[model samples]
Structures are given as C-alpha cells and as structure tokens.
Target: MKKSLIALAVIAVSGTAFAQSSVTIYGKADIGVARSIGSDVNELKQAAGSRVGFRGTEDLGGGLKANFTYEHRFLPDTGAVANTSSFFTGRSIVGLEGGFGRIDMGRDYSAAFWTALAGDVFGYDGVAANGGVAGAGYQTVRFDNVISYKSPTMGGLTLEASSALKEAGAKNGSAIRVSYASGPIAASIATEKGLAGQKYNGFGASYNLGVASVRALISKGESATGVESDGMLLGLVVPMGALQLKASYATLEVAGKDTVQQMGLGARYALSKRTDVYTSYANNSKSTAAKKNGIEFGVQHNF
Candidate 1:
C-alpha cells in the first residue's frame, strides 16, 4: 500500500508546528507467562522483556529528514526495568531516513539478524538456534554503537551493512546482507564477524506458493566458547484470513559430531492493522530431559 500523509491545518501566525518539526510519542507493552520442558527438567517464569518507548521525526523539507528514538524494556506486571540496562535500551538510537535509504548510528541489529528474525513469530519465543548458526544453541542478537546503511532497492534487490566499534585495538566485526524480491520470490545472503574471534556466515531464501510461503537458512559459526557449529532451518508460514500460521524446524551440529534438531509451530491472529496475538510451540532433542517444549501466547501492538 502506498503511504499517505495527512497534514493538520493550523494558523500561520507564529505557527509552531511547521516553523519547527514535531515530536511524536509511541510504544508497545506486553506481558505473559512461559514454561519450557527439557528432557529431565521443567521450569516456569514470569514473562520478561516487555517494553515501552518514545520516538520522533522531523521534516527538514527538501526530501531531508532527521529523527531520534529511545526505546526501553520493563516488567509490566512488576513494573521493573532490566537491571542497570540501558545499553541499546531495547533498541534506542538516532538516525535519518529518506529517498536514498537510511543510516543510523547506535546500538543496532546486524544484517545477519534476518535469520534470527525469521523465527520471531512472537517477537522471539525462545526457540533453540534462534534461526542462526551462532555455533548452535545460541542466537546472536544486536550490537552496540553500530553505524548501519541501507541502500535503495535496485532491480528487485536491496542491501544493508552494519559496523560497530570494538573497544580498543580490536577489529570491530561487520555484517552485510543483500536480498532480491520480485513478485512471489525473494532471497537473501548474509554474513557477520565478531571481534571476539567469532565468525558467522549464512544464506536464506523464500518463495510464495499460493497462500503460503516457504523459507530456509544455513550457517556455520565459531566462538571462543570452545564451540564450532553448523545449523539450518526450514519454515513455512501460511495466511488464512485473519490468522497466520507458522511452522519451522532447525538443526544444530557440533564439530561434525553431535547433532540436535528442533521443530516449532504457531499461529498469529491479527486483531488490527498493527496489533496481533500469537502462540507457538517448540520441541528439541532435549525434550526427553525437560519435555515441556515451549509455548507463548501474547499480543503485540506496533505503531
């Protein structure tokens, strides 16, 4: 759908609205309880990482714009913020966006995050592998003070890159991603390197088949955790009227020795344009140990 802008009519006499750009406030809050089942262990915990925040945008005119955002997380039920945690504060930053694309400098998501996000059916409901090859059993999230650039789409392809400053005397790792989408087909390639001697590379592709879409990803990674691993994921998301159904399977292999596999299925009901309620379940090799699998039923509102 083409975006539409609505201008409010105001007096020109000492007009404060246009003379200076305006600030907007918006945020999201959600809470839920969760339980996971391992082979021999089972645990329950109050929902965590619920959040809220403020964001603003200003028009400099002439197709130029400036903006800032500050997002934070809190325990809605207990009303507590993540302890002394403001690093990225749940995605805080300042940046600009225009016709040529966008650039932002601050803690950010790497281009490799695509695989991670592919499994975020409920804003990430704690699935093993989190859809990346971060040496298996782990999902690499965001980086700090990242300068990210996104290029305008060209010939059905778009590209993104991010770089973060590693402390001192360190080679800050970087991530690059490229994708092409035309009609019912899309594909992407991504890779990342961590300053702590960790490295990851992967590729993903998707195709629309009638009311459903199919996707797959594969990656290999190394980390100082004495772990070297490889992994892959296969997923399908189908849309049915007001609801969307998702199912996925993933595997993690350790040094060509042991392999752990997982599968998940879920459904999302769109309550409105920017609001949704979802639930999902995951099972892994450890199921025999804690076998609760995992389930989350929650709502998310975005503006």
Candidate 2:
C-alpha cells in the first residue's frame, strides 16, 4: 500500500507538469492532377506539400518559453512517406524564445527560403515552383543539423540567420535574411553560401494597393566551377470576394545562352476557412527547345 501510494503521487506530479505545456496537432492534405507536354498520362501531384506536425510551447517562467516542433511529409496519393529513410524529413526543431528573440536548432528552412517564398506567387510547389522557374532553384529548402536565430522586429525590420553543421561530408551551409514590412510595403534581401563555394543572393519586394498587389524578385547564383546564372520574377495577385487571381512571369539567363522564360496563371477559390480549390497553368520556354506547358487542378484541406 505504501509503494502504490507513492506511485500515484508521482503520476499526479507528472500530469501537472504536462498540463503546463500546450501542444497542438496540425496537418495539410493537398493533391492534384497535372498534365504536361511530354507525359503520356496525366500525373498526380502533391501541390501543397502534405505534412502533419505537432508543436508545443511551455512557459518556463522568467519571460522565457520553451518550444518544440516535429513535422513529417507524406504523399496523400499513395500514403507513402516522402522520405522513407528519414521519418521527420520536413522539420524537427526545439528552441527557446524570450525578450531578446528566438533561437532554434535541428532541421529547419534556411534564411534564403523564407525570403524566396515570401515573394513567390506559386510558392515552391512541385512543378510550378518559382525556384525552378526563376530563382536559384529549391536547393536551399531545408538544412539538417542547423542552428538558426531571429531578432525581434523593430521599426518594421527583422533579421534572421542560420548555419548548418557539416555532416556526412556535406559542406556546411549558412544564410542570412533581412526583412521589412510596414503598411503597404514589404521587402527582403537574403543570401546563402553552400558547400563547394556555391553562392546565392536575392532581393524581393512587394507592394499592396488595396485592390491588387505586385511582387518582384531578382536573384544571382554562382557555381563553384565559375558558371553564373541570374533570374528574375514578376507577379501580381488580385482578390475578389473569396476568389484570388494570380499571374507571374519569370526569366533565367545563363552566361552565353539565350534567356529561358516561364509564364504562369492561376486562380484559387475558397470554399471555407480551411478548404480551397485551385487551378493553374504554366509554360516554360527555352531558347534551344520546344516550349513545355503544364496545367494543374487541385484541392487542399487544413486541419
């Protein structure tokens, strides 16, 4: 009886500690059908990057808090893991937040990604990604074994920096981003350095005039082997009731080659606060090849 009483007391204490923390489960499911010029059959696509995650925060007192997040990506079509070898390929992070700012360590997006995605009309979605169509590609989406820091916003300015530790012979990566958002204007400048001296720099800005918004981004990339590429993107978004219309044009120029151009148009309709349907079309034109066009339609749900 004495031992049992002690066990119950311990359980109660543990329960109380758990109650001090808040945890939430969230996920997104998105799938679509896409048709391209060279495909014999239309392919199903993961339009919004399906993911499930848990995030929690614990008030540790003294104006400081502990936070953690774990997320995994999966394919809704086949119910298969996006990265079979790594369970939490999407993100796994833990850190602290206080008056100074926030710092996290684990797998997280590079600073450059935040900047690029901010200016992207189509985001980094597969097939229609602005990175592939215009920017320096999605080469710096996420980094493992990383430490990132964010400064508190002051005077409409915020700063972020991150570094990835070298693991498995992969080169160390580092990135920085500076952003400002005030009233109807927002802008960001970001840079990244990857293994083998690959470097990327980008600047983006957007302005909203109530009725519509315009966004643009320019990026330069240099390969370790001395080749260079420059990219530019321009996009517009218009909102009408529950519907949004978007159009974008992008160009990529490589040394001694004709510029590659891509154009995209899309529309999204909101069925509710948590569900939406979208349709989009993209055309990629290269100087040395026939133009390839793709069309997509899909629905997404968040919970």
Candidate 3:
C-alpha cells in the first residue's frame, strides 16, 4: 500500500513538472542561388528558408494551460533580414494558446495563406503552389494586425480561421482551413476571400503516403488593381534514404487570355537533423501570354 501511494505521488509530481517550464528556440535557415532565363537575360537570386519559433507553456489548473509562441524569418546567404525597400520587414510575432484552442492577435499569418502553404510540397519552394515567384504563394505572406483562431483537433481533424483588420472601408482578407492526419497520411483544405476592398478566393489540398507526398492548389482574385487571376498547382515529393526528390507542375491563367505554366524538379540531401543541401531546376512559360520562360538551380542549408 505504501509503495502504491508513493508511486501515485511520483506520477502526480512528474505530470506537473512536464506541464511547466519549457522554452526552446528553433529556426530554419536555407541559402540558395537561382538563375532566371527570360527576355534574353538571366538573373541570379538567393534566399532563406522561413522559420524561427519559440514556444512554452505553464499549467494553470484543472486541465487548463497557458502557452505562447514567437516566430520569424531571415536570409542566411546575405545575412539580410528586412523588407523589400531595405527598411525593416519587422518579421516577428508572439501569441498565446490554450484549451479553447488558441487565439493569436498581432502580426500573424492569414488562415487561407497558411492553409495553402501547409498543404504544399517543397515548403512552397519554387513549386507553383508556393505562388510567390518561387514560394511566396498567390497572395502575399500576410502580416499586419490580425486575429487567428485554431480549434482543437477533433478526431484527427483541425480547423483554423483568421481575420486581418484593415478597419472600416479598408480592404482586408479572411481565410479558413481544415486539416487531418492519420497513419502515414496527412491532408489539408482551405479557402480565402478578400473583404473590404480587394478580392481573392482560393482552394488548396495535399496528401502524404509515406514514401511520397502530393499537393494541389487553385486561386482567383479580382481587385481595384484592375485585376483578374486564376491558378492551378500540382506538386510531388519522394524520399530515398537520406535524399529527397521533388517535382511539380503549375499553371496560371489570368482574366480569360494570358496564361503561365511552370514545371520544376529538385533534390535534397540531409546533412543532419537541422541541415540539408538542395538543388532544383525549374522552367516557366506563358501559353497565350508573353511573360517569357525561365529556369533555375541552387543549394540550401538550415540551421
């Protein structure tokens, strides 16, 4: 009886300890140079992987806990971490989480954008799904003032919603995402629509089957920028030992005429848990447009 009592006490104490004091710093830094061939001109580009997360939690009581997270991105090649105008991108945010799931207010990602990105291969890389010329996605990586809600996983299913406040009469975007993971497979679907002033709507999904993962995405937008756009994306990634293989095809149609199609292939070698070397070759073309065709290759590392 005494041993049993002691064991119970130990378990209780251990559980409490597990609930408190956990501070960890994690980030991913990837560097790669690229070549773009279009208009009889070639350009070289380098970039950094997006990651930098710190989180912790403290038990409150009665199955309740408090938690927080902070994240950011940086360029490893040139050691530059700023906005496009050489000012400050100010790329960092902090938020909290708990039983009702989590509510983050500050400079946070849009539900739609995160959903599209979460379901893509190459972590958005040069894959069409990434949309950002390489991995920027169709819409920009939203930040500013925002509120996001993430519901608890309900039987392998998760839901996320977000809104960025641009105030009354101001153009804003709203997004939602649903995801599920089971066994050796994971999947996510999402949609985003613009409100206030601009207009954007999109759908995306992805699946992983142990050795290979596949992704797809589509988006449309109309805005005061005299804009009309549509896009379709497909991607694949296969793993072989410490090496990974990636391939993808993407197509974009604007208004009812201009079009862009892209195809890319790449390889990644794991150097360690936090480091890898990568190289990719990609080409882009316009079916009925004049955007020209382009190709690229490079390597990357994370730390």
TM-score per prediction, in order, is: 0.81, 0.90, 0.77
For every candidate structure, what is the RMSD over all alpha carbons to the true structure, in angstroms?
Answer: 6.1, 3.5, 5.5
Name the 10 consecutive residues with the lowest summed lDDT in model 3: 127-136
Off by over 4 Å in 1: 1-10, 13-22, 39-49, 119-123, 126-129, 132-139, 168-171, 224-227, 286-288, 301-303
The local distance difference test score of model 2 is 0.84
Clashes of each: 10, 0, 5
Q: If both were scored by lDDT, which would come out higher, candidate 1 or candidate 2?
A: 2
- Model 2, position 140: C-alpha lDDT score: 77
Higher-lDDT candidate among 2 and 3?
2
Model 1: per-residue lDDT, tens digit, 1-303?
123222332354337656567666666655444455453333322333556666778877778788777777765656677646673377767888889898888877777776556533333544322444332444346777788888889999999998988766766868888888999888777778776757776777778898898877777777757577887777788999999988887777877754656777888798998787766677776344646476666666766
Better of 2 and 3 by TM-score: 2
Could you give candidate 3's per-residue lDDT for residues 1-303 as a string of tens digits? 999999999999998888675777766655455555343444444434555677676766666666666665556555565345422233334455666788777666677676556535656664222454222224646656677889999889999887878866566667777877776556666666555344555656667677787877666665546566676778888999889998877666666654566777778788787677777666676633353444444555444
Flag regions of model 2 displaced more than 4 Å.
Answer: 1-20, 37-40, 287-291
What are the lDDT figures for the candidates, one per model? 0.68, 0.84, 0.63
Give lDDT tens digits, candidate 2, residues 139-211. Answer: 3778889999999999999999999999998889999999999999999999998656777788999999999
Clashes of 3: 5
